[model samples]
Target: MFAASVAVLLGAWNNVVITRLPGYPQSYVPVNLAATGLLLAGARFAGTTWQELGLERRRARAGIGWGGVCAAVVAAGYAVALAVPAVRPLLADARLAGAGSGEIAHQALVRIPLGTVVWEEVAFRGVLLAALLRLLPPRTAVAVSAALFGIWHIRPTLSAARANTLADGGAGLFAVVLLGCAVTAAAGVLFAWLRLRSGSLLAPVLLHLATNSLGALAAAAAHRPG
Candidate 1:
């Protein structure tokens, strides 16, 4: 219960940082690092081994291979989505409006992967999932962690919608948040599965990086003025 509470609080804190720190994007690095430290410290306090947290190095290569496969699948799916006229507009990102190709590349290839994905995967799949497993079945732990992961994206999704002017009213914003949560929860299950299957956090981290980076690239391409 203590671990769960801490995880919830930390998740809320993460939401605040993600939504409220737009003007200070650089602050995300240190804030995420601090969150990672707290999760590691909590794992130690709860007697969770590094191996149990999927921090082992032995299966890293296999994990990376699987991650690549997952990434390819995601990229293909995004391509299909982009090709579909109905779905294409939904993927539009306002952040790309004034962003150069270099900025988009950096966001996709570097900042998101290192600054956000690693910290999130470490916290949710690594530490929180480990904690939950001690008190619940494997599947239950995954579901719970995934649910929290979905909830954690609420603020960011809403914020993004507002930034993009995608939502017109409270109802629209609510719908956007709901859809974002559901999608993220589904993705979280995939991430949790990768963590369990590979017995290493590396797989999910790579898969996540691929998803974000490729998605960003696709969005940038779509929004680029022809």
Candidate 2:
């Protein structure tokens, strides 16, 4: 338990550092992958596997199904929100477009891409979640893991708002924090639940990877450059 907790904290700290580094978008992929790799490797070295972690196939299947449904729900909800004028604009920005509005171009750099998705799933959902499950009860572990995952986004949210913070520090930061927590907490629970039930981590990973890919595509298509 102690060791697993230590690993989780280390991963969280690594995210803190990685997300703050220059060229964050690129840096995050490798750093997050590496941390996840180390945790999984450590679990194997310690003789822990899914079976050891209490991941029965039956229960894991339930988790995966529920997780997939939740992921679908979130995606559908976001799609609906984007359809509405009031909130669609919040997530619109050309920076994400990366000079590629063409369908082929947008298809090129979708969030998780095919090649890297598997590796990331192996690392984050597979390794880290398993480690947490070993250290905590299945339900508790999933909840904590989800919360941690949500908090990981805090740095980027704040960094993106540096100017706003400079203009209105506490208010801007508080708003971002509140917003981040609410959204990521829901995402975290869904992802974690999926990971727990699937027992493969690939399910939630694919679910997330697809969300990033399709959501980005949808966002790009829905918003026009102003």
Candidate 3:
């Protein structure tokens, strides 16, 4: 199990770095899909069952009900955040500046859900967490998976830091990356908890969609044309 988990994490790291490389497929949707397939195949080979991996159909109703509530909360939060004068600037990420509606729609609807959300949810909250639960207590499993998930984002966070001036110098960039890791780690815990609580990936999947996709749309809306 340990070896399988390690291999999956390495594959994820590769995905993170490679997908961002020049000449890589745009949106990386196919990459994520392929990675997800391999990850699930590897997990099953390691003896993790669908139920253990949070794929229980019986849990779907609970997942959807709670997930909808959580998603609504997230949407309301984004709406509030976008409405605030001081917070509007934060929502208006400069990276999204001047993006056409089509581009933003692609990002929020297609790129985010398929490219970013699906694989991570499946890998972290599904396969990795399931594998860990077999070896550790529920809390420990969530923590380990969450920590690994956080580490997995380091390369992307570093890349993002380089794209913006928010991280001043080397030290500032380091701080930014560190903070990003911490924030994502915490998010990992939330996601894992949701997965465990509802016994279905649908719970975390819906919440993740709301958190990311809606946030992207909110950011685009908050952005004012100069």
Best by lDDT: 1
Predicted candidate 1 versus true structure: per-residue lDDT over 21-68, tens digit per residue: 654677777667776887788788878998888887887887888887
**Which one is best on TM-score?**
3
Tens-place lDDT per residue, model 3, 12-40, is: 66436656666575737777778789888
- Once model 3 is optimally superposed onto the true structure by TM-score, how far is the C-alpha of residue 55 displaced, in angstroms? 0.9
Note the Cα lDDT for every prediction shown.
0.83, 0.60, 0.82
Query: How much is 135 displaced in model 2, in angstroms?
Result: 3.5
Rank all candidate structures by their lDDT, best first, as comma-separated numbers.
Answer: 1, 3, 2
How close is each model in CA RMSD to the real structure? 2.4, 4.7, 2.2
For all predicted structures, in order, the TM-scores are 0.88, 0.68, 0.91
Candidates 1 and 3 compared: the better one by TM-score is 3
lDDT value, residue 152 of candidate 2: 60
Q: Which residue runs does candidate 3 get wrong by more than 4 Å?
A: 2-17, 20-22, 25-27
List residue ranges in candidate 1 displaced over 4 A. 17-23, 79-90
